[model samples]
Target: MENKTKKNAVVLLSGGLDSATCLAIAKSQGFDCYCLSLDYHQRHIAELHAAKNVANVMGAAAHKTANLDLSLFGGSALTDDAIAVPESETAGIPITYVPARNTIMLSLALAWAEVLKSQDIFIGVNALDYSGYPDCRGEYVKAFQAMANLATKSAVEGHAITIHAPLIDMTKAQIVTLGTELGVDYAMTVSCYQADSHGEACGLCDSCRLRREGFAAAGLADPTRYKKHV
Candidate 1:
């Protein structure tokens, strides 16, 4: 049964499959979802467009885009034009890992959550089948939650904040299955690290590979539109 009073939640939406699923999960838990997307000057601005579409389609109470020039720092491939995004699998954390990206995004989400008087913040950071980002790990989420509780005025006043990562331990296939069960339109979500202006995926990047494999494993047809290569 649904709760009579729906609690508000701030969801960090990236317009990707995982984040979309995360938002669906939050709504399922009876939270009034407020979707948050960041325009941090990444190569694929297409996902930001996807974010808006997803938020509307998923019935979010409100959606907001925060603009910032993370490209000014330019330490990673996504934000730096100098570094190239690798099409093939690479060892270690990969060049596509934005430095402290999840931390920064969560900080923004925390601020919004405090202002909205929402104690729950949901992020879609998966540890499995991901590009090996350090910030996506379980420990990182726990540490961030700890910091958020201590740093926020709401927490100090006995309204503790919780950071929810529903997909943290789930495999890509599992996430896909869950999202499908929740009626998420996978076609509207873009997981590509280098999507074209039209939001068509490259279908050769690490993110694309993972997404493809996930659908295959889930026995679901991939609905992603791919760009044609010469």
Candidate 2:
């Protein structure tokens, strides 16, 4: 751990519940957090706004946003405007999966972490109760960490950085519970792919369903605005 008396980390804050919760977790760990959000041409800019709010509320040491046009390589619903965000059964890997999103985001965060001389980067990726995004898995994150260490000067100099996924194994309900204990305001975060103009969550989408069910399982009140109570 290299005697981290000045422990600092870069957090990938998507302004969603998980990411926001991750930010809180990082803070709780006594890390001076630097939050990074991306504008990857997703359907909703609302999430970006929520990210900003979360960063400010959580008291990030620094908050930065990057504008990357993933739509330029459009294939997923998040980038391709032609495809609608699905609300059906997620049989396999959903179409909404943006190719290499976590990879790209982590790459950028790695660069920032090196520049900041931070020892860790926190991401909100989860494997349980999540759409089948491969990058969210523990193996993928581990591989990325190794790659990051090998690819950067910091790692080459024996400053082995870590990619922290505090929510990797947690279900959404457990996540919600942790966030609630951390005094996180779920209403301030947006998790819906199809959020309305007013920032209300579309209760029919996979994300919405998972979020609602998680809250139900945790016996917590979801403060998010839903299009309908399913």
Top model number, TM-score: 1
Per candidate, the number of residue pairs that clash is 0, 0
lDDT of 2 by residue, 1-230 (tens): 23356588999999899999999898888899999999998988999999998999889999999999999999998889899899876788998899999999999999999999987999999999899989899999999998888899998998999999999999999999999999899999999998977788889888888998999999998798987776
Q: For residues 69-89, write the lDDT of model 1, one tens digit per residue.
A: 899999888999889889999
* CA lDDT, candidate 2, residue 105: 96
- Model 1: lDDT to the true structure: 0.94
- Extract clashing residue pairs from model 2: none
| Position 120, candidate 2: lDDT | 97
Q: Name model 2 segments beyond 4 Å from true.
A: 1-4
lDDT per model vs. reference? 0.94, 0.91
